[model samples]
Target: MPVTPSDIVKFIESRPGRPLSAREIAEGLRISPSQRKKFYRLLESLATEGLVAHLKGDRYSLPRKQNLVTGTISVHRDGYGFVSPREGQGPDVFVPARFLREVMHGDEVVVRVERGGRPGKPEGRLVRVEKRAHTTLVGLYEQGRKFGSVHPADPRLNQPIFVPAGQELGARGGEVVLVAIDAYPNEFRNAEGHIVQVLGDPSDPAVEILSIIHKHGLSHEFPDDVLAEADFLPEEVQPGDLEQREDLRDLPFVTIDGETAKDFDDAVCLRREEGGTSHLWVAIADVGHYVKEGSLLDQEAYLRGTSVYFPGQVIPMLPERLSNGICSLNPQVDRLTLVAEIVFDAKARRQSSRFYPAVIRSRARLTYTEVHEMVEKQLAETIERYVDLYPMLTEMLALSEGLTAMRRQRGSLDFDLPEAEIILGVRGEPENIIKAERTKAHRLIEEFMLAANEAVAFFLGQRDIPLLYRVHEPPDLAKLQAFQQFIAFFNYGLNLEAEGVDPRALQELLAQVEGKPEERTINQVLLRSMKQAFYAPDNVGHFGLAAEHYCHFTSPIRRYPDLQVHRVLRQAWRAGGLAEQERNRLADRLPEMGEHTSRTERRAMEAEREIVELKKCQFMAERVGEAFAGYITGVQPFGLFVELKEFFVEGLVHLTSLSDDFYTYEEDRHRLVGQYRRRIFQVGNEVEVLVQNVSVERREIDFTLVDLAAQQTTAQESPKGRRAQGKSKKR
Candidate 1:
């Protein structure tokens, strides 16, 4: 048979991250010189097919595979690394520290697959650095007479950059400074750098956030041209711009979000139609109207991809003039909006939907708390304040219930996972960390937003127009089977088929486990098993939401994909259809745009999660001696991970703390069983622990189990990492 795409792909994949020359490939595939041109073209096609990566010197390698992987490294403080693949498949490959001498965390690299330390798994051998995640890093400078060394704030970047005394840039020994790389590490040479920016003293509490900003290369300031364009934007909705747009200013629309939220990009209202029907209006700020495509604002927004929100700080994508001023649907202000008018019949089934540009005056700016108080708890003051909108709000709640029921019936999974909500003090210190509950009011807006998003996505999809789609493919079969085995410990088995798992099966499993002590663990495992939702040119149904067509149509101010969709919607709306020429142009660009937006979105999420995690560590650092009641969230061979009920802070309890007997880990039960006493520490078991040690460097806290039966001791044992201590007797 002639050389097929699969044959070429498999051959390249066998040597993942290793480039093979076309001539070599031709020889390996038995292609003569006369047939070489067609094979060469075929190799080129493979290079651009998103499967194989084309390297310099006319070489190629597989971009995605279990063996030879291509992706970014996530280095742990322990010196080991995990490679998160670009293709978003498989568990991250483990790279031992011995192979990590040349690469830092987040560096893009190809890894050659090797036999794993564990059975039925694979390990990775570092291949080559395709791209560097950063050329600069933020670290503390230690000045010396002859030279200065900077230790990276990110412990994962263990290599200290050697900075010459003259290159210290006047930074003191204890000061934090940003260092520009003079050289990347190699087998023979260590990395070197020169100080480019001298940050303030490490003692500054605000420096923590600054360190994260610098570490992630996030900018708080906009370019001069972008700023100038933002400044020149009209401060209010102008009359001339109102042409050919619906006037919804007369309607009673309201903005409902958190009290601390500054940007109200979406305002919602509802009207009861005859025959037990409901007409819902979700008006999102028409950012596209002000920030035209290819404009400075558009370029900046696309670059940012999405806003990064740290506690008490927000690095917005658009300038405040646009994101918070005109584009924000502040109460009593007339803001231009793209409206999604959806009609749901008695059974809460979407009957008809329409999209158009409109202008609306937000009558009231409510919050999730206030709405929850009035609707669910029936708070007196809240009801009296928005008395006219009270009836409408209750009706909206009823409609939300109906919509939620329909969604639940369609096998949509609702993971009742709590979020870590950091409460900041006046001085930017984390005063408290609590679990943020997802309330009915939050769900109310969510149901409406989902309806609108789906309607818009379905609209464009049916037209065969090229637009970025939010897709979540099904879980990998191995992961699904693992999860099924895990839940079997709780006397539950998933109704999964041999072909693969279904969303409904997972949904049914969650429903079955709800309210049980194992609910949290099950939810976490299920979430981990599922693929992440991302923006892509391809349409794969969103598994989490169980929706056939879904795109991010809300929050255009913060997200780039939503803005791009708005622009595409306008083009298609104006032309009555996408012109063939325009469609082809978009087809060429949409795939790349999807990839870029997805990457940036993940970057923002990582930055946000890191900051929150760091703050949690800092918060725990202050209360080292305090004892708190908690539950065993995770159990490994070395320790039990516990989440304190009062503070929502999770810490590790080393195996040494269980002084009564030695313990061995049982992977199937996710627990440690004592060898002699047969005592067990497993997931979901409530336990009390004393905060022993906290390491802001590792972003972790150490806890010791409080032997409530034994006499309380003032002595606190230090928290040791899994591999930090000597071997256990059981081991």
Candidate 2:
């Protein structure tokens, strides 16, 4: 038999702690002369993937055997970076600034771990870059006497791209432009690139948002083939489309969403039975029916993975013809859907669930504000407007309340953190920033969706069907321990002797700090200590939700994983169960599908966050020198992050700006202390601050204390003041 990759790996393993050349490896396997070229290529490919390390003299060995590690490098704006291993579990290897001269952020590279480094963590130097993350970047073009350079919009990309005279594309000095890198940077030379697109002034709000879109590499426009396919789809559901779908047109179903929502993907109907049981029907648009597997539309949707929603714009996975037209569950229109019909007891505990295809005509489209007024406030005007649907709405409210109680009883975490809502002008400029409201009606819809998702996940998991689950693994022990230490400052404790702590323990701690002064700060820190939720093939369970089986089955119009779940459910339901062949096929592909969707979801979130910060900076630019009441939300070695009470905008108060006294950071206590005066700056400390500077391009806002002396006087009498004085006296 011909030699394979496994054969090569085995041969290399045989000679442990020794690097061997390709010729020797091939000779030991009795390779022919004709196979020499192919053999060398195979070895090179393995090295590129970090499976093997290529040392001097063209010899190869396993990466671990040579103290070499491979992974993507995430660079901080300060120039240092860390390499997270691609295929194993361990601490990330830290790479100092001097050792990162030849590599950029997000580049895949091999690192050689030094013998002596930071305690309990490995430090390394970049050996070779295996892959580059960016070939093109968006930046501000700065013209020089002889040539021009593009300063990257992303702060992690510290090096400037050198653009020669003729390659400037007629861009002005301060214009935002896109540049294609022809040569990457090294120790001896700067990166070289040519301007490709001039994207107007950076000060323009539209240009600022557009620059972020390009920086994240988000696909905003659909390809011609995908658009053509979307156009070919029917504008409305046809007669044949309802062949096997249950007709639920007479049901009083309604869609409750934001006033600005254009694409409605889910609708709900709840019925109260005589036996004190509730039957809930959640109907999700049947997007899988139109965007078949391997079709142009499906390919594009898979590539996008999830729709990216900006402040006033959205980059949808499918073309608008489908996302907002035929697939949207609009009121008074017959739309094809996949229904999750679940039965619940008086306590809102799920009794049984079934999935089926259906066709439904929604009775009305309601906004969250209206629903809140009708349900929570009991407004006569709002209830009179939807008089026919009020009884069902009341029943829905009861079911939602029961479900909320059940989840809370099971230790489901509700962070209840405030989010900023950016009010924009007609020209897309931010006019104001306010805290987003989360009313009972919002929770009602959220509870219904969560119930549907859990029901679907449990249904599929019981049958051992292959699908992607929304998994949130338990927090790392080290992180949990550190969190315990931090919360101890507030006289809070957790049982951390065991390997895994119960979710209810965390739930109780949150309850203890609910209305305390340090509530937001503690909540933020505990949230950071938990692991991020992601989609995976394995059923690891969701730690935050306290669910044994969980998956994304709602909102197929925006999320790809939900569409895949729908397809699998329909196939399995029609055939009574999935066959062995079908199961194997799905099992083989779901892992990769999960990974891609998770990555795209994170990318979209980052883009959304970046745009919001940019807009906040723009809004604050006009308010410089104005004082506002605020509180410190975060404390680090370098500075304090203060959030204004009026606008919900956060700005950094740098250490250098505190010229009155030199302060040292207390990492364990999360505070800053003065050397002589003994003033304390800690999390949750209220103060007055003035906006000093705003850089929209960098998405930064700088603040300074309005009156440091008065603040210090006020802090001198607080509980923290006593501790600071006691520590100073001890010193």
Whole-model lDDT values for every prediction: 0.87, 0.91
**Cα lDDT over the full model 2:** 0.91
Candidate 2, residues 192-277: lDDT per residue as tens digits?
99999999998787888779889988998999988988889999889999998899999999999998899999999999998899
**Top candidate (lDDT):** 2
TM-score of each: 0.90, 0.94
Looking at model 2, the pairs that clash are none
By summed lDDT, which 10 consecutive residues of candidate 2 come out lowest? 708-717
| Superposed Cα deviation of residue 561, candidate 2 (Å) | 0.5
Candidate 1 lDDT by residue in tens digits, 1-731:
79998888777767654578988788888988789999888887765543676665778876544356777799998898998876654567889999989998888787877877677456888877767878999999998778999999988898899997688889989899999999999998779989999887775768878888888877678999999999999998889989989999999999999979999889999999889999999999999999999998898898889999998899999999998999999999889999999999999999999899999999999999999999999999999999999988998999999999998888788998888999999989899999986889999999999999999999999999889999988787888999988988889988678777777777778888889888998899889988888999889888888899999989899999999889888887788999899999999999999988998898888889999999899899899988899999888888999999898788999887777787899998888998998988888899988888998877889998877323324222334433334445337
Best by TM-score: 2
RMSD of each: 5.3, 5.4
